[model samples]
Target: MKAVVVNEGGALSIQNIEMPKITSPDQILVKVAYCGLCGSDIPRIFHHGAHFYPITLGHEFSGTVVDTGHGVTEFDNGDLICCVPLLPCFKCDECQKHYYSLCKNYTFVGSRIAGGFAEYIVLDKKNAFKLPKGISPLEGAFFEPMTVGMHALLLADGCEGKNVVIVGGGTIGLLAMQCAKAMGAKSVAVIDINQQRLDLAKKLGADAVYHSQKLSSEAIHQALSSSRFDQVVLETAGSPVTVNLSIEIAGPRAKIALVGTLHHDITLPEKTFGLILRKELQILGSWMNYSAPWPGKEWQLVSQYFIDGKIKLDELIAGMGDFDSFIKQVTALNGRPMNGKILLNCM
Candidate 1:
């Protein structure tokens, strides 16, 4: 099978490798259909080198079940499925507490195990969920990222009747806006350095959009003086500038959730300490979900929403190209601006 392998930092090559074998009875083999290149995967593959090379690097994907193990009764051949990507040791203390993300022995699909970037990938039958009826495999590839947004909104407390602000207008940031609105936020605003992305956000569901370059701290304060955001969510993984700005614009006692990642050190302003102490703000850091909020709710909530048209997953697709062309497109966007998510059609 042909697969893209990163042998080292700043290196990626497409090569023919042996297909992965099902080594365990609880595993199911899936033939890759489509995989989305997430922002985190790009940096981890090329920048910090956290992704071990000679291994597949895509985690956000969906495929059809080719075969199932002896004990696999829940799924069968021809059934399409998407997984949580986290394979946790169910006996661990954190798993016992239903916090699989914090499990000491947690293993993610793309990072710790062979991921979905190849023609075939194996997943624990326990972690895979059947793709709901009428959900396309392409849209199924987005379930992982959507779950991240769902987790962030849950971590932000409740969005009901609250004014919310989301920093960054990328895929994750835009998805976060939709999640906030679904949770009943009265008004939602998305801010980004890219005008193109902010425009896309408005088209999706953002009630208002602002370009970071056009708005300074004073401008933000003036805009919010009449209606300050009760919840602020940050999905820009670029720098800490937006994180601190989220802090600055938050209403008194507002909740702030950081959903994006920063590779470099983040510094908070000196006044932030005073603001935190005086305003009683609650700041929370969020990441990929652990898959434990409700029974089968992970895919069901998101799948139903997309299937029923509550969220516009179609508009989120920015670019789609063949294998080689797709890779070039991703690498080219390294320092350029992106208005939406990019996908690769491996079939």
Candidate 2:
């Protein structure tokens, strides 16, 4: 098997490696099919290092089951599946409360262990799910990110029957928009620094789009036909600018979910901080999902939506290539602007 290995110095090299085998009775071995490149992968590959040197990093992926342990009854050979990356110790306090993401003893695929960038990866049967009928392997790869969006929307208090604003048009941001609409948002406006992404956002059900460079309260009001987004605002850009702007774009008493991650210290702007007080907004910081309502509802909901034809992710796919192309594309992702998700055909 071959995988793009991130060496200790953050250099990416495609190298032949031993294939992972089922190490536990509850585990399943899968043949990697399509893996999507995440924005976080950019820094993890070029700047921040992985959990260990020579690790393969790809969490948003889907594949066919090559073999399943005898204990696995739900899935069998050749069934398409995607998995929630978090592997929680069910005995922890957080896990007892079904908040797996907050579990103290959680491990992650593609981060803490070997992942989908390779020709084969192993997943605990509990973490793997068979893709619903009518969903292709590529669309199956969307399950993870859609779950993130679903979790963020839940943090924003459901998005039902109210206008919303999403402050980023990247993959996560766009998925958040779809989740909002699916949850019955009255309308949505997506703001981004990249016009190309904003255009893509509009094509994928964003009612309106704005470039952050020229955004203003009045401009956003005009776009959504309201003084502010009274329902919810999800900040997926994770910069000081977008997070603050989510505050500015929110209406009085609105709930704001900060979903993006900022890697460094941020000096909070005075005016934005004051707005929180004046508006009496409920500002919440959302992290990885609790996987609640039902175990893995995030994955189930996204899967059913795709199965029912309520959602289609064709527009989010920008390109497809082999392992080498994935490396080149991801290397340039952070510093450049691209509008869609790039998938690597791992065969």
Candidate 3:
């Protein structure tokens, strides 16, 4: 099996590795067909020494089942499936409380464990979801990120009849916007410094889009004051500036969800405390979809959203280049299209 591995920090290479074998009754082996390169993968590969050297590096993916262990009943060989990627000890207190995403022993594919940047990977039956008939494998590859948005919305409660503002126009941010709209936000606004992403956001149903760089702090304040959105969603990778900017624009009594990974420390405004205290704002953090129901039910939720036209999945795809080319193209971030998710076909 050929897999892309990061030998060490700042080192990446393709090597022939032995295929993973399934030894547990609850495990299933998937022959990967497509995988999406998430922005986090780059930092893990280049900056953080999180992954063991020579480990595969991909988490968001979809494929067909090549084999299943003795007790597997939900799926058989040849079924299309997507993985949740988070491996958890199902007997833990967190798991018992339906907070598997917060399990102390949680591990994810392509990060702390073997992953989908390879020809085959073995996953627990609980982590693999069967794809719906109408969805293509390429689109199915997006289920992981979409599930992140779904999980974030779940944390924020219902979006019905509320004005929602998403800070950042990246893949997660854009996906969150679509999900917020589908959940029935009265209006959805996306903020980004890039016009291309804003245009893409418009195509995907953002009610209003703004160029963050061009707007002065007063202008930003004026804009927020005018819209007065009750819900603020952050998926822009928690860049410090964006974090404070998000807090600055939030309306009174607003609910804010943090779906982005803050790479560096950010300076927050003292007024942020005033808003939280005076307005009773809610701050929530969401991680990957690792809890509840089986992986099949979760993937079905994403698939249903796609089938029912709640999310514009296809429009978010920036390119369909080959797997290797996609790695090169997507890894180099430009201001524009940084907000869109790119897919790579491994088959």
Q: Estimate each model's TM-score.
A: 0.93, 0.93, 0.91
- For candidate 1, the per-residue lDDT at 30 reads 92
Model 2 scores worst on lDDT over the 10 consecutive residues at 221-230
lDDT of 3 by residue, 48-89 (tens): 655467667788899999899998998989899887788788
Q: Summarize candidate 1's per-residue lDDT along 1-347 as a digit string, tens digits.
A: 87777666556677788887778888898998888877777766666555465667888888999998887888989998876787778888878887766778877888887777778888888667788789888878888888787776777766788888888788877877787777788888888888878888888888888777888856875676656646555555457787777777777887877787786798887896677777688888775675565323445678877777777777788887666877687777763445577777877
lDDT of each residue in 1-347, candidate 2, tens digit only: 88978876557789988888887888999998888877777666766657677778888889999898888998989899986677888988888888787888878888898778878888998777788778988888888888887887876668788888888888899888988888788998889988888888888888888887976865664565573545788888888878777777778888888899997777768887899999899988887755764346777778777877767587788887898887777665643535688888975
lDDT at 285, model 1? 76
RMSD per model, one decimal: 2.1, 2.0, 2.5
lDDT for model 2 comes to: 0.80
Off by over 4 Å in 2: 218-230, 293-295, 332-339
Error of 2 at 36 (Å): 1.1
Q: After superposition, which runs of candidate 3 have C-alpha atoms over 4 Å from their true positions?
A: 224-229, 295-300, 330-339
Top model number, lDDT: 2
Better of 2 and 3 by lDDT: 2
TM-score of predicted structure 3: 0.91
lDDT at position 159, candidate 3: 75
lDDT of 3 at 50: 57
Computed on alpha carbons, the lDDT of every model, listed in order, comes to 0.76, 0.80, 0.76
